[model samples]
Target: RTLLSARAPVTLISTSGDPPLHIAAERPSAAATLATLIDAGAPLAMRDGRRQTALHIAARAGNSVAVATLLGARCDPELRDRWHRTALHWAVVNGQLGAATLLVAAGATVNGVPMPIKKHLKKTSLPLEAPLHSAARLNPASGAQMIELLLRAKADPNLRDQFGQTAMQVAQGAGWSPAQLSLAWEQQYVHGLDYLRAGSNHSR
Candidate 1:
């Protein structure tokens, strides 16, 4: 939690840890740690146990500082996780708007495709939905804002999940109000689809 503290003085920050920052970023928290480490002169592109870099951590954590730190260090934004999801993928899913913005600015692929629903168990499951699907499911202010972020960044609106569900479909399934859906989609052409998939499309 040292690196996560807003009170941590930036200058006294020592990035020392076992395995160095490069190999430590495989885990979400570790990846976040590595971002600061790399910013402090740790290896720039080392992959962790999962072959993921610090950027992946920032993406998962939704920390814009981590994202920019990695990008500034020349970390690959397009680096894929074992499941083939990129940092961009995680940024949208986890709702890291600032990181998401930096990824776009750094030339990350806003149009990156979904990984594929390789598994879905109650114990462990992520359907490899599009970033849009992930965001819509959140139905938060960031969710709507991310739609615009993705659209302006040129993410594909028509991409589908394993169930052939569109982002709009998932958003509707998550129960976003018609007003919410309409406002989001109207801002970008993504909601133009009928969201025809058969699901609740509702959210918390």
Candidate 2:
């Protein structure tokens, strides 16, 4: 409050690459603190060391209230982090379905692909990835729910990652049986065959 009253630059980056807003957004009691910062003219779009915005931090922390506050503040849900992953990707990867849902409702692209990192940022080339790929590869236990949410939001079931594999293929390679995928699909979309047919056609 003192610094803010004194007009201290709220956008100053910390050594960890987070701004004050990003740090505050990580806590469950973040709503008041975030609102204060935003009201004090804090820039909501500033990125941390990893290029993650306040919304990304809130999503990764599973802080749905904070995510909602940020969204209400008109933060860009589509902003990408250093890994080219949006808040939706982080939310799905962390199994924060609430946060993912909020992001999806805020117009985050369900099938948006991560941008490839520059060569200097990696020892070897890395491929772009989609939110579904993260859910399938990193959060398979609840990935079906995440997939359902994305699918309901009109995510492309057949969207492939840099590895040239769809989310279902990734799930299958990760030991999710065809039965599991089928059941998950049925649970979300009543006309499951449409999505299945789309996936099959895209693979060809």
Q: Candidate 1 vs. truth: CA RMSD? A: 7.6
Q: Count the backbone clashes (under 3 Å) in each candidate.
A: 10, 2
All models, RMSD in angstroms: 7.6, 3.6
Model 2 root mean square deviation, Cα atoms: 3.6
- What is candidate 2's lDDT per residue for 1-204, written digit by digit as tens? 777778788886678777889989999876787889989888888877778899999999999999999999999988887667789889988999999999999999988754454542473343576787777765455888888888888877667776677777777778776677786666555655555556668778
Instruction: Evaluate residue 169 in candidate 1 and report its C-alpha lDDT on the 0 to 100 scale.
Output: 74
**Model 2: runs farther than 4 Å from truth?**
114-126, 138-140, 187-204
TM-score of 2: 0.83
What TM-scores do the predictions have? 0.71, 0.83
Candidate 1 residue lDDT tens string, 10-113: 33422543244533444445555655665556655555656666678767776665566667778888877765678988888877787788888898887665
Residue ranges of candidate 1 with Cα displaced over 4 Å: 1-19, 22-41, 114-125, 190-204
